[model samples]
Target: MEYIQVLELFAGLGGLHIAVNNQKDANIQVVKSFEINVNAVKTYQENFGHDVVSNRNILSLSTEELFRQNVNAIFMSPPCQPFTRLGKKLDVNDDRCNAFHHVLKLLPRSPNIQYLLIENVYGFESSKMRDTMLEILQSCGFYTIEFLLSPTDFGVPNSRLRYYLLARKNKKFTFCKHDHTSIVKEFPYCTCRVKSLNDQASICSNCQREVNTNISSLVQQNAGNAAQNSLVNPGKLHSYLDKETDIEQYAVPDKILLRYGNILDLRTFQDSSSCCFTKGYTHLVEGSGSVLVCSRSVTIEEAYKVYNEFKDTDSEAALKSLRKLKIRYFTPKEVERIMCFPDNYTWPKDISDKTKYKLLGNSVNVHVVTLLVALLLHS
Candidate 1:
């Protein structure tokens, strides 16, 4: 089998890189990665045993320099802060937002590059940046397919909804026909079905009833455990009180209350999925942080428990047990698992926990990426 050469831009901690590595048919090799954070680059290098260019502003790399490696595909997930609705929505004017422009300018120089994949927040679809990106691809004679997908759709418990763009230079590439149907069929594990706002409202009464029934059962099973072990109220403790408490006392907060309170409520369980796991956990100061006021954030072990329970059986017993564990948040390895990264893959052991969290938070869920890549390669 012929292998595909990949150059990953804004590689972060190599989430895309790991997913590409998992491709069975393609000889996926990440020739280079451009990252601005030194710690992130360090972690990337440590995990992949590749030379990651650190602190190198992506705009500074010329088109010739990027194409010098003769890459066949380029995969990127740019910093999403500019496009996220939760943020400033700075769009094209944001310094980070301009990175996509740089990528577009570089693409024309690489004729051998047959494929391009970009991942970002769902808000990217509406942003001016997305329009410009589509226009650039069309001008370059590439066809594109865009979708908003979540990790839960891929059988992962977390509801990480992101925008994914797959572009191909070949005229034969049809976004509608290129195995997206089979991709969805094969990955029924994914909770992120492509549905329009109209279709969501059009669900028949029977479908809605079934959905409600399932949700109610899930809530009753997980809510109690989540309340007893996972939830916490941060507002109750003054900042001064946090400092005064010993590390041990602060590590574990009061059992999370299910009812709404001034904390990270366990009510998140009642909803369909968990919040996007971000590097926010690193900023948490057991007692003082604003993110979550629990004994510890959910750990990798716990995350795995949730994933296994949700994916394998959707069993209430498993979820209840997972809620009771009192570990600090999941390790990077565990996060990798939740993201469907293969167990044998290597990660940088030397990097700080903060960097790992940032990398995982920024990465594309491997299962989804793998499905995309397979479709491109086979189609």
Candidate 2:
């Protein structure tokens, strides 16, 4: 049988691998993954039925060793911290950002590989590392197509925007240009604005009775809009409520809501696409910043909903089962969904929540990689 063989590097939670494996018509198979984080390795092993070589950094792995595996394609999502706007943006000099260099070095020694796919933050295009990687790929007889895309464009609820590069050996691929004017029309859900606690309290008087005055004042001060204070009394005490009620009735106050609005506002220029979800999401979920304070972090079930929205109906039952499994952070199954892994794949059972988060955060979204793979297959 003619099959597509893939070698995945930085394979956090096996998202790319899972997605490729799920494609009914695509003959893609992940032969191995190179990852250094033990937590991520555990999660990757759980879903893919492959043991990730943990604690062994990609830089230490030899090209000859990797070549022995008979890889037809190379898939990677290098560390974006060095190029992320949230980080120092150090580019090639960042010690943690060494994978790209190793990938370039290995390419020359592995000319048999027919395709290369890379995913990263948008800032990569402007970085020296990006230029160098592009140069190496071009020199190695790969035609490249680069684009900035978001899950929202394909109906995923989150605005996770990322940069994707698809290259094929000795073949040309056309780069798709994004039309800024068409975004709002194409993705109406991306325009969802932050809603304030006061606005929510007005609709749910039950919630207004629970909020304390001090917290309300702080929320007002931080969110920057206090005109809706009359909607609720300051001396009320907050009470624990069900998940749906909490989101609908007890959302952060107007003051904090303003900050979330600002965060969402900052994203307007980039169209409806969301900023990348990273290991940083844990911090964002736990923090008191405007983004965290005003808007709730997307839950695992919610993430499933987003993924399902973009997917075909045939996977609905599988998505529901995965969503109902209900573990904090994404479970190996949920992580598989994000990676686009098939329903029958098995995950490692003994992974930690921290590991799951780290691996999923580090993974490439499966749909994104599938598109790149499809381009290569056609090329």
Kindly list the per-residue Cα lDDT of model 2 for residues 274-373, writing each as its tens digit: 3344664433542211121122343434544544554355345534433332212223343344333444545466665445555556666665455445
The segments of candidate 1 whose C-alpha lies over 4 angstroms from its true place after superposition are 1-3, 52-55, 174-272, 282-328, 344-350
Summing lDDT over every window of 10 consecutive residues in candidate 1, give the lowest-scoring window: 226-235
Tell me the lDDT of model 2 at 10: 80
| C-alpha root-mean-square deviation, candidate 2 | 18.4
lDDT of 1 by residue, 1-379 (tens): 7667888899876777766765544677778888888777776776777564455888887767766777878999988989875679898999887777888877777677778888888788888988888888878888677777775554345557788877788645442444532222222111122222233443324223112222222222322111111111111112112223233422323233111112342312123334566655435422211222233455535644554546446545544444454323344554555555555656556676567666677777776676566545554
Mark the regions of model 2 whose C-alpha exceeds 4 Å error after superposition. Answer: 51-55, 174-276, 285-355
Q: lDDT at 171 for candidate 1?
A: 44
